[model samples]
Target: MNTTELFLVAMLIVFSIPYLIWRVFRTDYWAPLVVVQIVTGVLLGPGLLGAALPEVYGAIFTPPVIASLNGVAWWAVSLFVFLAGIELDLPLAWKSRRESAVTAGFALFTPLLAGCAAAALLLLVPGWVGPKAATWQFVLGIGMACAVTALPILILLMEKMDILRQPLGQRILRYASLDDIAIWGVLAIILLDWQRVGRQVIFLVLFALACWGLRWLMQRLAESDRWYVALVWLIVVALGADWCGLHYMVGAFLAGVALDMRWFDRDKLDQLRHHVLLVLMPVFFLSTGLRTNWTLGGATVFLAAALLLAASVGGKLLGIHLAARVQRWQPGEASLVGWLLQTKALIEIIFANVLLDKGVITSGTFTALLLMAVASTMLTVPLVTPMLKRNPGLIGRSG
Candidate 1:
């Protein structure tokens, strides 16, 4: 068949398989459709499907078809990341400064340190760190991957559980929002290219000026115009960031961050996020799957994934428990919040993809991180549901 036919066949597979599994198996209790989609992406990747059926994989995922899919995937993720940035409610976080600082700080650092130690151990083995990475870069990159909260996915799960607008849910959003800022900041540090520093500086300066003018203009435009302008702004900033060697994802986040959420209608913004996930992100997931590798052996990769999952889940809970103690939170609050905060899906995958693109982590390492992210996200709702049921009052706790 021709490239277009093959591309449609691939797209059909991407959208259909995951939806069937989610529906037929009723996996929504333990695994949401999004989580199922991610797992399916891994299973459909070269390491699994290609290894099992090389000719079929090659026939459907021809070079041109893959390129087309990648183009779609890139835009999907950029828009997703952009929406996540716009969702950040930093002012609300700052209002409860002491509590937010303590919770966000611990929630971020504990997993980070644990993941770094895990990364340090991986460095003792071969094939985990990428060829272009320095020891510190690889370690920090891996550590940060572990610490990602997938604020977008977290928002989805909270909405599913009917807590997104609850006091507890809002609190969780605050913690995740602060961590989101730090996550991107650290990514910039890791991606910093000394040779491109001047270009990056210029990009930032121009970006700042552009943001000021954009904000002024956005304030006067109708909400409808703001949406169109935001897209144009998203593309321009993303292009500039890529040119400066910081990665377009960073640019996308910055573009959204510069805009006020108040400028857009809240319901419309939510719908846009939902529509992006439904129509576009599946392509990104399939593209992500294509990048996974098990050259280090499936057992080894699974082992690494298990180790990272333990670090991410354990460290997040430990940190939140400590914060709970300090802040005198309600009895079940820390456990519930920690489990929710540890959720990682799209953001972790994006973080690993950036690391892989920059050669800070090997494809094998990316595969493991991907697996860990899937597992971490899957565990969130199941664990949090029971905790919420047993202590329903926790949902209303403001602090």
Candidate 2:
């Protein structure tokens, strides 16, 4: 087949396979369709499907097809991140700043410390650290990966669980939102290129000026017109961020945050997220899966994945439990919040991709982190359900 036809084949596989698995088996209670899509992507990657069917992988993922797929994936993630930024709810986070700050701090830092310990231990084993990484970079990068919470996936889960509009739900969003901002800040530190410091500084300065002008223009546009303008703004910011060496996603997010969330209808914004996931994000997941590797041996990757999972889960629970104690939260609240906050998917994958792109972690480490993210996310609903059932008061905080 020509590259275009082959690309369509690739697209068919990306959409059809995961959906079939999700719908056929009724995995919704345990794993959402989104999670299934991510898993399907991993299964279809070179480590598994590619190894078993090398000819198939080679043919469908030809140079041109792969390039085309990546283009779709880039835009998919760009839109997704921009939505996440628009949904940040900074005003709410600020209103509860004291509680939110304490919770976010504990939630983010504890996992970071545990993840750092796990990353350090990983160094004793070979094939986990990328060749281009400094020891500091690998350690911190892996640590931060462990600490990430997938904000988008968390929203999906909360909505499914019927807590999204609840007071407690908003509270959880506050904590996660604060941590989300910190996650990017840490990434900027990890991605800082001293030789390109001049470029990055210039980008920030110019970006600030541009944001003022952009927000001013956006404020004056009709709500309907704002939608189209936002897309243009997203692309422009992504391009500028990429050029400054900070990465396009950073720009996409900043572009969203610069504008007022009140400008967009909440329902439309939510639908946009759903549609983006349904159409374009699967390609991003497929592209993500294609990068998985097991050259260090599948068993080693599994073991490392297990260790990281323990660190991530244990640290998150510990951190939340501590905050619960301080805040004098009701019983069962800590466990529930921890399990929910531990949800990680696209954001974790994106963070790892950045690390891999920068050569801070090898494919083996990336695979392990990927596994950890999948496992952590899968555990969220099952773990939270029982607690919610037991505490009838916990369902949307008396709403």
lDDT for each of the candidates? 0.87, 0.84
lDDT of candidate 1 over 148-258, digit per residue (tens):
998767877898999977888888988887787688778878877676788888998999899889989999999999999999999999999888877787788888888
Clashes of 1: 0
Off by over 4 Å in 1: 296-298
Question: Could you tell me every candidate's TM-score relative to the true structure?
Answer: 0.90, 0.91
lDDT of 1: 0.87
- Top of the candidates by TM-score: 2
* Most lDDT-accurate candidate: 1
Total clashing residue pairs per candidate? 0, 0
Clashing pairs in 1: none
Q: Write the per-residue lDDT of candidate 2 for residues 1-399, one digit (tens) a residue.
A: 998899899999988998899999999989988898888887777778788999988888877887898899999888987887787666666777888888889999999999999999999988788878889888888888888998778877887888876777877877786787688778878777675677778888988999889888988999999999999989988998888767787788778777778999989988898899778888887777766554545587899999999999999999999998998888898888899998997789888988887889987888789889999999999989888889868755521
Worst 10 residues of 1 by lDDT: 288-297
Error of 2 at 266 (Å): 3.3
